[model samples]
Target: MSKVRVAVIGCGSISKHRHIPEYADNSNVELVAFVDPVIERAEEYAAKHGGKAYADYETMLAEVKPDAVSVCTPNYLHAPMSIAAANAGAHVLVEKPMAVTDEEAAAMNEAAAKNGVKLMVGHNQRLMPPHVKAKQILDSGVLGKVLTFRTSFGHPGPDGWSIDGAGSWFFRKNEAIMGAMGDLGVHKSDLIRYLLSDEVSEVAAFIATIDKPGDVDDNANVIVRMKSGAIGSLVASWTYYKGEDNSTVLWCEKGVMKIGTHPEDQVIVELRDGSVEKHKVGEISTNTKQLSSGIVDAFIDSIINDTVPAISGEEGRKSLKVILSAFESQATGQFIKVN
Candidate 1:
């Protein structure tokens, strides 16, 4: 098949750091257009990446009609932009925390199915080597049935990562909605579900905005009950002053598994039989390295092969439901059922 024509709908840090670069490197992809409210930003990326710059995404979508489009805009814009891209006859790959609410997420999924276009979410944690191995191990029953889990994903904050320092859209309640829970919590929710092959059934949470000078939450501590009768603790923070702490530990019937926690190994497996194994899974993307995500390549390949994306819109919605339900749990001071 000929190269897949692609457009990037947001020229933010994520697009510049991951999406644009990965798509450019893929021999099967042709960058066709770049869109950003700040037209100059789009122009800069277009000049370097071989695409036209547009201040308006609708205009670009109508004109270019790309085969695929990546939506890397603020949290609030994810659903509308993805639905628009699908409606314009383009497959969509959108950033995570798919939408702020279940209704919006459902709309996105419906739009994609209606248009016969695939929709994938950028839940990059699922693409990590160690996490992938953990899934395999769990499926093999080597760890037996997972009984409990503790997972955390934290960093200084998006002020340092987003293109607009301090005043980034991530700090805006209107745009980002739930802050740390939506930003980092959603990732852990998705990873836990993926690792155990279970859905989050209920959540009781203490979501707060501590230390971060914003109305949105900077800290989220949640207790979750999975459909498989497994319980877990999930913590997402923006006040990890020391550095990032992306880690998860699962306690199973026969053994324990550690991911992204230890210094030497990416995954550490210890069994009751006094046997231990260390897996040197490759490094995942960091701020300094900003390594390729492999998401763009997967999206392009799924289109070429005429298959559904591994992280489909429906899957993305399920993950979003976990976070949104956490917020509701915090507000009600009780466990919120994830439906």
Candidate 2:
């Protein structure tokens, strides 16, 4: 009946670029409180969004009592913040790669369930039109039995991210955990899962920080075997001198599909009969980089209608498990089974 009051736990780039704008722009939502260790950043966002600023999240939770909170903190903070939000009687919308470990992801999921709050992971790519269309085509049986697949996501290093060129948690091993795999690889892993409607059961991977001046892997790739008998490969890099987001290519028995903006652009469906259909999709984002796509709208709708989000916490955990396996596979030099 009333607007959903939302609080954002981090005021960094992601919060500025995606969560703040997304929550502010949604008509059914009210941006109510902001939180950041740096109070100034939180205050700025709060002033812009017509909400209160909070230097401490516990204080905010005790006072504002938001209906939901967006966990925009770093890789290491995601699990703890999400669990806290759920325990504080608020729903959660967490950023990608749910957590660094399957154990953490499971904990977040369990906390949400224990509190009876919905836990949604922001795998924004899945919200893109091209990805949505590709999933439809794959499920339509036009793709026939799946054969092999490849997907990638690459971006230039984060050095050029802010105008100031200041350093951030992205380069910190304690904060980032894994490099490209967590930053971009999870997107492709999640995308393929959504498109193929299957689980990645095993992984063989190579991870290295060949480019970025960080301890974590700025470049990595993995070969995956699906439970459904389809094989897949995931590649991601922050070392690309120049490249767009990325794309996923699937070759089934009857047809093939590609998603993301990097390739020929949008969702391209090519049938074995030599017929090709392409969609020139725009970004899922709006004025700000936050996914303005129908995906978040669907998340909101699911909350309102009491339906399950297609990109639920379980789905997010599945992707995290794959990326974690990728790291383990690289270490052991053996196929790692996903949990």
Candidate 3:
């Protein structure tokens, strides 16, 4: 296909600010449809982007027959929508925390396989230049073996970013499941795995609904042990009153690496030998205006080249496993093993 026909299944803030705009910028994609339960929202986007507005995604899939679909719906709807899109003969680019449960994620994976379509999850952190460089540095083994690390992702709350603001589906437990953990922790989980090229073996956590207006957790402190024998702490919080903090510090045998810790420096590396290397790899997007996640470009490039997406369905599932295991650990008050 010279130009992949694309449909986006959600007209929320994410779709409006990131996916839709990015797809329009990509020369290899032709925006064909926009879907949302709220017809007005879909109509608004469709009017602006030159596509049909759809209240029902299945109908859009049947009529448009898009070559690729971006699933940006609520957390609970991700799996089913992605599966439906895949079954309709479209490659899928699903938003993260692939699904609320492993079963649902596995079902989505199966459906994609059955339909002979590519399934990628929106683990955008892995595409960041600094994170990619960090992966390269770690893979080179110059830091010796990674010993331990602390990674965190936090912000004031979704009220500032969600399409519905304070009344967003993110605050509802049934829709979001676990708020901060699912929203932010999963991103870190995917990032850690990418940086170290290791999977988490166990998790112990303290998750709480501290100072958020809903039933879901606002803060989570999780300790994890990696299969590579490295230990680390993963924190997700909606109570970061100061500002957004999306940073990771990896302590290796010979040195340490800091990622997304400062506005001026994207990656900071310091060795025990008193040597320091600071990488100014641009800035991370903190708001909608700056949402150049490199996600849409990568997704379109993968389709154009017929190559596997960097963050595949199984890769997304592995990251979800970390967050789910943390929830289990919090409930059991013990370290939970990851499958």
Candidate 4:
């Protein structure tokens, strides 16, 4: 196919700020449709991006027959919408926290495989320039072995970013399934997995709704043990009122690698021999200052090239399992093994 015909399933903040604009910018993609329950939101995107606006995704899939679909809906709808699009013969690029349950995530993956379509997840943290560089450095054996680490992602909350402000679906448990953990924690989980090239074998956590006016947790402190015996802490909070913090510090045997910790440096490596290497690879996308997440480009390229996506459905499910295990750990007050 010369150009991959694409459709976005939700006209929410993520779709508006990331998918639509990126797809429009890509020369290999043709924006075919936009779907949203709020028809005006869809129409608004359609007007700017040259696509038909539909109130229902099912109808849009049937009518547009898009080659690929970006499932940018609520956390609960991700599996169903992605399954539907796959069944309709469209490749799917779903947002993070791919599904509410493990079964749902598996079902989505099954649907895509059965339909012979690509399934990519928006675990964009792995695609960040700094993260890519960090992975390279880690793989080069320069940091020796990652002994312990701390990764955190915190912001004021999604109220300012969501389309529905304070009453957004992000606050509702039924729609969001989780709050800070699902929103931010999963990203770190995926990043850690990617950087370390290891899976989280177990997790113990404390999850609570400390400050946010929502049923879901506003803060989570999770202790993770990787399969390689590396132990670390993963923190996710929606109560960072002052500013956003998306940083990771890895304590390795040879040296320490800090990512996003310094304002001027993206990755800082301090060796045991007292040498320092600071890398300004590129800007990591932030809540306030948005950048091309690179997810849309990767998804489109996978479709055009008929190759597996970098962040495949299985990868997304694995990262999501860590978050789910963290939730389970909090509920049981024990170290839960990630399956």
lDDT of 4 by residue, 83-202 (tens): 999999999999999998999999999999999999999999999999999999999998899999999999999998898999999999999999999999999999999999999999
> Candidate 3, residue 281: CA error in Å?
1.0
TM-scores for candidates 1 onward, in order? 0.98, 0.94, 0.98, 0.99
- Pitting candidate 2 against candidate 4, the one with the higher lDDT is 4
Cα distance off (Å), candidate 4, residue 39: 0.3
lDDT of 2 by residue, 1-339 (tens): 998888889888777776777666789998899999989898987777789998888899989999988887779999988998899999888888789888899999999889998999988888777777777777788779889988888778666663224277878889979878998899888988887778998899999989677698898989989999899889998877765557678888988776664444577778989998887766444222445645456667777777877689999999898998888888999999885
lDDT of 3 at 196: 88
The 0-to-1 C-alpha lDDT of every candidate, in the order given, reads 0.91, 0.82, 0.90, 0.94
What is residue 339's positional error in candidate 2, in angstroms? 3.7
Question: TM-score of model 3 relative to the true fold?
Answer: 0.98
- Model 4, C-alpha of 10: deviation from truth (Å): 0.6
- Candidate 2, 292: how far from true, in Å? 1.8
Instruction: TM-score winner between 1 and 3, please give it.
Output: 1
Counting only residues 3 or more apart in sequence or on different chains, how many pairs clash (N, Cα, C under 3 Å) in candidate 1? 0
Better of 1 and 4 by lDDT: 4
> In model 3, what are the clashing residue pairs, if there are any?
none
Stretches of candidate 4 exceeding 4 Å from the true structure: none
Worst 10 residues of 1 by lDDT: 283-292
Query: Any residue pairs clashing in model 2, and if so which?
Result: none
